[model samples]
Target: MSDVSARDAARDKARDRDGAMSMAGMSSERIESDENVWTRRLVTFLRVMAVISIMKGLYHWAQVTGFIGSEEEAFENQSMAWQTATVYFAVIELVAAVGLWLATPWGAVVWLTTVVSMAVIELMFPGIYGGSLTVVALEAVMLGAYLALAWMAARERPP
Candidate 1:
């Protein structure tokens, strides 16, 4: 082979080798730490949270509209308008989570905003049961989940 041909072949081989490890839907970034790997998995979980957040908002809206009742009595503590607002906010939160998982730049913004909302609400609201037995659980969990998604996504260098 000519020098140019040999050089081209070498570059192609290197690229192929780099690509091989990523085979079939795998990512090129190899996570070095176990915690970081789990953090990435949390991003996938956050993607699922996209659907859950929307559903949760709908459920609240349903309650306010009289289509459903709160599974927990604590919801009775909140007013109908408050419930409605919660529904609207939750839906927005869900949409943002989805956007983030999709790697839209706005996703990080949504995640940060919602997680702050979550932290604040969790501090304010006491559920039907004491000591963490409430929808506060969701606020708590999703707060971390959104943060994790944002963090991991930041680490991700898109292919």
Candidate 2:
């Protein structure tokens, strides 16, 4: 090969070794940026939320099983339907918590459903379920966070 062609080939090889080709149009200096930090923080926050959901589910299970509170205290004066619904809540919460821990889309969907179901039940039967504004607030905040993360993730593009 001509000397000029060989020089060009060597330069191409050096550029490839430096990740110039693999990075598409991105510069090596711009490869690692604030986006990475935000992505990491978002993932960490989601995982922490998952852990909280798991703990909340376990707490509900404990309440339902009379481990933390007496069965009579938990179901006292509540109708049979409310008691049954409590059991359902415990089961769904635990399952959704597991899904959230796995970071799957279905996990978020199920968790939102569980939250909405609980909110609706509490609202519709304030007496039977003993509704609390705190539940609504917590669920709203969590849902907001989930939605924001999803929006941000979707907006993210190669830079």
lDDT of each: 0.63, 0.75
Q: What is residue 23's positional error in candidate 1, in angstroms?
A: 15
Q: Which regions of candidate 1 are displaced past 4 Å?
A: 1-43, 70-81, 125-138, 145-159
For model 1, residues 36-133, the per-residue Cα lDDT tens digits are: 56556765675776666566557656655666665563456666645655665756766775776685657757765765665555556533122253
Among all windows of ten consecutive residues in candidate 1, which has the lowest summed lDDT? Answer: 124-133
lDDT of 2 by residue, 111-141 (tens): 8888788788777777756888788778888
Model 2 error, position 20 (Å)? 12
Error of 2 at 125 (Å): 1.7
**What are the candidates' C-alpha RMSDs?**
7.8, 5.2
